[model samples]
Target: MKEIESSNLFPDRLYLIYRVGRLAFSSGIFFLFLSLSSISKLPVAPSSLFILGIYVIVSVALLLFSKKPYTFEFLLDEAVIFTLVASNVLNYNFFSIFLIFPVFFSTIILGSISGTTSLIFGLFLHIIFFLQKHNEGIATGVQTVLNSTALIAMFVAGLKLERKLKSQAFYIKELEKEKERTEFYKRLYEISANMAHEIKNPLASIKGALELIKEGKQNERLLEIIFKETDRLDRIVKDFLHLSRPSSPIKTEIFLPEAFQEILQSLQHFGKNYKLDVEPIKFKTDARGFYSTIENIVRNAFQWADSKVEIHCHKNNHTLEIIVEDDGPGIPEEEREKIFEPFYSKNPNGSGLGLSIVNKFILENKGTVKVEKSKLGGARFVVRLPLSEEV
Candidate 1:
């Protein structure tokens, strides 16, 4: 069941109650007239007025109660029971007809179980009342039963229609989300194309200037800093181009422990200057996405860690779990969530797309990623990958 948001809870409950109360009030008035008319031909005894008084009081109380917050289940059950008893007390042929309306209405709104329960309860009351007043004729009982059966049929049809509508709504929502994603990619491609065109001339000019300066003429430290910054810019541009391009078709399979170990080994070159400890465990995951995701995260940990980083893996029922943590200063609490957003970074020199790419890959593989304070006294990234069913 979809959880009801706090904002909509009270108003929805009140609306349902108000609607049922209105129906009850209208039915109560109609029955009042019928009962009065039926007793007119007979003596106007004190007993008649007393029963009439009880009906009036109950109706008034119900009308007031209907304004309060109540569930459909409570309303349907109470209405069905009250109507059943009232039908016998009024002793009118048309009184049983009122029960049919509530029965049909309950089925349409309360779903199969509650609706059917209300119908059965009302049916039982009708049978008992008819037996007590049998001299009225067999036609009346038959008509009542027929009406109840028709109401049940209508309820089944209404449920089918509701399910169809809900499915359509879900489909539309998915389409809307896809459309938004496409538009974002479109805008990204346009911006990257423009940036590449505009930056080419400046990049060529800087490269030419650096070359013209004799190999030993420039200060070694200054030359190194300039080269590093240029390389960083080049990497950023490459990342932008990659993200703007159409994604490659995914061919995924269950990747074993060895495949993950290979990815970790490849990333180890980047962290050779730092002390890195990698722990492997047997697990299953989508090969393509898992390789790309782990490589990105491990490389990121290497960039931040001072002298040590750790990788651990484990398996939970139907899922492969991995945690990558570093001994570097952890990300601030306020920045952890936003770090996965595209082009967001706390470090001035960071490209900002590393975690974002990891996030995308994890989602595509039907997995999840979360960041928290690690047991290793730094940021820890926990990834959960669903086990591949095909393998």
Candidate 2:
């Protein structure tokens, strides 16, 4: 992201250039009128007076034009060119110094390249003044050079400082965004967990009654299907409750690979009938939070995987990376961001809270989860957890 400069001097930085330009032109007009009035008392040339009048008219017109919302490019180029022309016409040697104001102002408002261009244009105008015989020999040259050089130096320094400020601003923005995401997931987890806890008893009662009905001499296949569905719903409600409630406060230092081993063992016991392939590698993370987060992800992977599932973990500096990939149908890009939202499941049978819960767990543990195309030709979940040292 590009950083924008914020200074209290201007209400809006983009509009500031024009504001400064208008002020400069108006001030130039007042001084030009004073000079012309004073010259009138002396034996100045008629040509000089005529030139001053023309300068005033053109400067006023430029001031009015500057009031409009012209592009920054046009404003800088036109303002500098016109100011230079006006200075030459009015035989104003001090106008070059006044031009420096806008150049410095433009650099602060626009950026380095623009400020430098304006400064160079001002230098070219000074050269024009020198050639026109408007200003004298070595003294005028030296003064003009010194003023232009100072303006250029100020602009360069401002550019460097502005860049530094912008970087800090961008970093702050990123931090804020991460904070908001964390808060959102935190609240969502709390609310869903509470609702799930409230409904758990009722779901359990229904599941028990359904099982009793299946145990009785009801139609065997129909009863079995109903019982199975009730069981799925019961598991969904339990998952919701688990996500809603806070885990035990106790934390342990568990190696990442051992955590995955436990998750694989649990998945095997839970999904013995379903085909699953578990691959493991070295991992380092917080034991309890990492276990919960991985369990949620692995469960989701199992649900989405057709008959194949792959879990891979890698290590980077200060982060343990895990990729849960499946061979089932992948999610579309448009729905990727929303899938992590609570109650946004794609499967008809899903409660839509699994990924939401996963997101909450990851965030609480200072990690992030994102969806992408899996190497297995299905949905891939990329998780990044801070290393133990960072924690």
Question: What is the lDDT of every predicted structure here?
Answer: 0.62, 0.65
Which parts of model 2 have CA positions greater than 4 angstroms off? 1-12, 15-238, 245-251, 269-286, 388-391
Worst-scoring 10-residue span by lDDT in model 2? 1-10
RMSD of each: 11.2, 14.4
Instruction: Name the lDDT of candidate 2.
Output: 0.65
Could you give candidate 2's per-residue lDDT for residues 184-250 as a string of tens digits?
Answer: 8997787667466545644665666577776884566656666666776776777767667765556
- Lowest lDDT sum, 10 consecutive residues, model 1, at 1-10
| Superposed Cα deviation of residue 193, candidate 1 (Å) | 12
Candidate 1 residues 7-105, lDDT tens each?
A: 234334644664656556545655665677687753334444455556456555656564542335334544544453454444345544555545544
Cα RMSD for predicted model 2: 14.4
Question: What is model 1's C-alpha RMSD?
Answer: 11.2
